[model samples]
Target: MSADARERGRIVVGVDGSESSKDALRWAVRQAELTDSTVDAVTAWEYPPLYGSIGWIDAPQELAGDIKGAASRALNHAVKEAVPPDQTARVHCGLAYGTPAAVLLDQARGADLLVVGSHGHGGFAGALLGSVGQHCTQHAPCPVVVVRG
Candidate 1:
């Protein structure tokens, strides 16, 4: 960490292994490099327990393992694909629980810029911003970047 690294804030991206998210990740990497920031490429995955937050239980034991494994794999693979070998040194990866919008909003607490893809599984073409992107932009503690794809 340098002077700016101490002074600068995090540049976080919400990714789910989608093409649009890959675009956001790429943009976030460049922003981090130019701004002397670090990339916090984040992926928020929901597990069965989260869906059962209302006190329901008894999900298969494999369910937890499977969701954690999938989330980690997606986070790692996105970092590998979006960040170049040289820029890799500045990259960080994280996986969390809850909805994409909620997760990214919480991550915004420490970030200077929160980046997200314009579309996900539920977004339509030419929508400019997806639901998560829209939520972060309006609710993030810092600046939000919607990397349109």
Candidate 2:
């Protein structure tokens, strides 16, 4: 682990390629720069079992491809593009599997701050805080910031 990682944890932010999430990533970079804290940009996934395989089998090739593709695109944007130039080195994107809320809540355990986007990629306009955001706010181990964008 690097010296920065040994500091006061990091600012964990959830990203799903949504406009709101992208905006949240941008804000998180600024926060990370100001606080001298790294940003953990996370995107959780859940892949179905492969054909002719047991439920306990490893993830299928297609699913793995999807996971890698999504993670790559998201990191490129959320960490490289969404994050401001001055804070690039402080931003790190991580991909995981499971429910968004559960993933974020778990990640928050080691986080100094938890940030989430209020609106989601596929959510309706009526929802101020989308289901995932609401869940995180209710169960997060650390203070949560629900950014609206």
RMSD, every candidate, angstroms:
3.1, 3.4
TM-score of each model, in listed order: 0.85, 0.83
How far residue 147's Cα lies from its native spot in candidate 1, in Å, is: 0.6
Give the number of the best model, judged by lDDT: 1
Model 1 Cα lDDT, one tens digit per residue, 98-148: 899998988778788898998976777767778888888888999888887
Clashes of each: 0, 0
Where model 2 places Cα greater than 4 Å from the true spot, the runs are: 2-4, 48-61
lDDT of each: 0.84, 0.81
What is the per-residue lDDT of model 2 for residues 1-149, given as tens digits with 9 covering 90 to 100? 87656974589999988888888888888887778788899988777555554446656666777776776686677666587676777877788778788989988997888999997766679867899999888889999998986
Predicted structure with the largest TM-score when compared to the true one: 1
Question: What does the lDDT come to for candidate 1?
Answer: 0.84
